[model samples]
Target: MTTFLTGWGRTAPTPAVLTRPRSVEELCELIGAAPGRGVVARGLGRSYGDAAQNAGGLVLDCTGLDGWTFDEGSGLVTASGGVSLHELMTALVPRGWFVPVSPGTRHVTVGGAVAADVHGKNHHRDSSFGAHVRSLTLVTADGTARTLRPGDPLFQATVGGMGLTGVIAEATFGCVPIETSLMRVDVERTADLDETLATMAATDDRYRYTVAWIDLLAQGRRMGRSVLTRGDHAARTDEKEPPAFAPGALVRAPAWAPGGLLNGLSVRAFNEVWYRKAPRRRTIVQGIAPFFHPLDFVDGWNRMYGSRGFVQYQFVVPFGAEETLRGIVGALSAHGTVSFLTVLKRFGPGSGGLLSFPMPGWTLALDIPVGQRGLAGLLRGFDRRVAEAGGRVYLAKDSRLHADMMAAMYPELERWRQIREQADPAGLFRSDLARRLRL
Candidate 1:
């Protein structure tokens, strides 16, 4: 019965009971006999917030169920809920197959990815994790296991239902075929907001993966200055015998980095260097590990934000609403918020999953140090602006979104709720986030 708090940026929960079940039968027993009326499944605890925390209820840590089998003929991989993408990639990459979709980090589990319906830079071309899912095995509140497929309405609801629907025990999804574990990448720099948007709009479709590194400290004429990166799976001939597996090369950060070390001064300097260092026109061949999971190179890196931790603010704005994008970036620059990681991307079509986050729009994500005065209020204001424009926030990365804002942002909320209720009629499967957001 080991207990651990979630990732940075969330208030710690004092769960009445926490259990790590190594098998589905054990998981069922724990759920059936829990003292509390509510329960939730927690994966790698990488959600950056309380979405996976069950304060007074039962919290099931599913990491022990790491099991997976691949069907080489069909290129389909069925994995246990606890298998992390890092592990999956290590196994599949050498075989010339890649996860259909992956978020920025590789430390997340299959269950967490599906529960959040995670997306990546390729979203503008491939949609989300849910889009690749073919089937899943879920454990309902009554301790019953049900296998569901894409056509099942309950399947869509559970895909991004934030674990309130049930415990995702196993999942099967299609994998993308790759010629090599290397990427043929193109890099470009944009001098201002207009150029950045124009470049992304004009060229996003030319590549399978696209993202922008925004200079959050830039102001006035230089506002929204960015470095755009576009890439696709490299052809075998593009590189000489793909880079060999070198797990030892992954570096981990020190246990502690001084608080306020990443303040305005340091961030501005770093952003300047990054913007200037990026080449206006360049093509390079790089390995998949560095390209997809840059942050994962450093272990325990979250400790750098001091004990208070940090929150990742990720929101989307529709295609035509350039004003919303400009306004948000301008506001952040005005405040001089210390955000070390600021990313911008264009999303294409969206999946019909009731709570899925992405759509045909531009999305911005930032990692801001916590406890900044009025930070919560500022994000709330941003939520309003997003909702007003028919946009929504990603629930996977949210920690402080209000219930009303959530309802306003997601018009399909009621439909998801109905399906969830039908699956867990007694409202037994729950979490602090579900209660807080009234989901």
Candidate 2:
């Protein structure tokens, strides 16, 4: 059927022929009969940009291929491409197992996790999702399914290749064994950006997960003021058996909302309240969902940005490039950028995924509604600064990055491209992101 699709940001809607493949055989058949424009796999539409979109072409909705099995002895799971993290969590949490790495949302599919090589709050300790993958099955452009393991060039290329190498059919990955679904969390507020960075750097190793909510609107003495939270999974005790793993959505965003609803004035107020409401030095036990995927509590929350949609800008700079991070944060504050959600986290190291985003550095992500004044030029300026500082933006969340900057930001881009080209000589796997970035 001809369907219009957009990423989670809800921007740049485009039409395509969307179909669901029930199994690997059906997926191969669809790929064999693909149209001139090529094809790409999409799962849950959690990608904030066009990475999963194939404009005016065939889009294989892989959600139908959701078969999976687990081995309790090894804490390993072999799941098909379309199974979502939420589904795994719903089933595994009660069984005392947790996904090794989870992004901000649990709705992402396992295939999407491998394609993006996603990271989360525990990245300072555990690394990305691809790091836990023991092996993966990919159906390449020639319709041959290949089983790839770590250390292989093709494996490294495909892990974070953004579905460009091929369709991820299935994967075997290790999962973390948790004694309980609850997390023992510590909450604290940072006076400014310097303290935020210093505090996290000083004590990061003590906690398995850590992140800060930066108030981007704050300036002068308050510039980069933040609320920091750090935690590790709670250990089993006489706590009346672990609770069930059901996460409920408290509310849904309206189908329609007016633009300019998240302007500077409103965001500042919300940030102020949110920051003040946080406990100064409190340690509490929080549910797994609240600790890891709080945003999932609201269905279609992206609509809160209204018809203009939003742009999720995520980039990482090396450990020594604190100046670059400061400059960018200062610029955003000076512009009074209306960003309701701005997060900062520290990364330990990069997985071998050549195209994977995370590296030993500091990463920041912001959600800014589209149509913000000078948004394009401001971000373009950031792109230049990031490239010069030896930093790279996350491809999964990128929509407006210039094609020329890709190679400069990712030093191994050429290598990744070579492997991708070899795996899919016909370039059968294509997406709007690839076309726009000239990949």
Candidate 3:
């Protein structure tokens, strides 16, 4: 009835039973009768860490629930839990609409996105994915489907509850109007940490989407030097012509890349070249595919991290905590961590979701190889600094945060846990993360 369990990064669990439920009823049935510590619904497994994984338990693969319908009058799209942003984008883009918020990768499922409360470059303007959600249908532990509205307290808890409350069966949210699936962007290069933050603060609001690619390998005065990319939805006049196709393309990567292929020397060289290549000022109109989901261009891109796999660490520190941000970046640089992708963004006000990850602050996300010695210790230290600054790490991207750190970061943890217990009194939905962090 079940197979093994693993995440997108292919980090296998200690052998568990995996169940692919084709419908909400099937999923509910499986969860209600699950034998182990309980069950956790898994999407496309796009989450880099164990948040979606339930070692030695039932892992419900929900990709089979991909169903969607659009309400033309309200511009609202209702999608099944398993529906992916990639699928939604392809269907909606040609119709002159876009998801209100999208993470860097489009492969994320609707359920996963809500659980993670994912944000994108536009976070400085819009906030997390949960902010746009109007309603959700959840299959509670009791096998009853309940529809939750934005104002409901349980709604906020479930938004970023990370599948702990119940299995998100369906979700309805508004879509943004767009002319073409394209973005009109401006690019700028900053010389140092202060310059980067200043530039972002100065111009972030001018663009609907904004992010900075930092040169993490740089040190001292050059520390945190970055290439800032800001963009707004492209207007009709800005586009020369409609794209020939909707750019619904997908690419896959080789099964594996050579070990140590992304070592310090290689990443440093890549970062240096990347820093130099950014122009001081430039304007470009790009397709939505390339602008929002650039990583999708290379299929199986995770292989680039090699056989050791990788973990994506994304954490946010409140505004005015520049020293905390600088300190974390400095530690990464000093450790020579070879992160292929390092992104920085300024988040706006957060949704009231108890487990929401973002707030009015600066958030940095990095992809680092898994086997780096002392990596866990380094992250623990960063966690302490973040907790001290009233910051929190994104649960969707975390695999190794300590229980005490989690409690300190999310002050409302107990509140969320109480609601979760009421919905799933027996704790029918659980994961390695939930067990490890005592959630």
Q: Which candidate ranks first by lDDT, i.e. highest?
A: 2
Q: Which clashing pairs does model 1 show?
A: none
Summing lDDT over every window of 10 consecutive residues in candidate 2, give the lowest-scoring window.
235-244
Candidate 1, which segments miss by more than 4 Å at Cα?
2-4, 10-13, 242-249
What overall lDDT, based on C-alpha atoms, would model 3 receive against the true structure?
A: 0.86
lDDT of 3 by residue, 44-133 (tens): 878877888777778888899989999878999999999999888888877778899988889999999998888888888998899999
TM-score of each: 0.97, 0.99, 0.97
Across 26-71, the per-residue lDDT of candidate 2 in tens digits comes to: 9988988999999999999999999989999999999999999999
The candidates, ranked best first by lDDT, are 2, 1, 3
Candidate 1's residue-wise lDDT over 162-226, tens digit each? 88889999999999988787999999899987899999999999999999999988999998899
Look at candidate 3 and tell me the lDDT of residue 352: 81
Backbone clashes in model 3, listed as residue pairs? 3-18, 251-299, 252-299, 253-299, 253-300
Q: What is the clash count of model 1?
A: 0
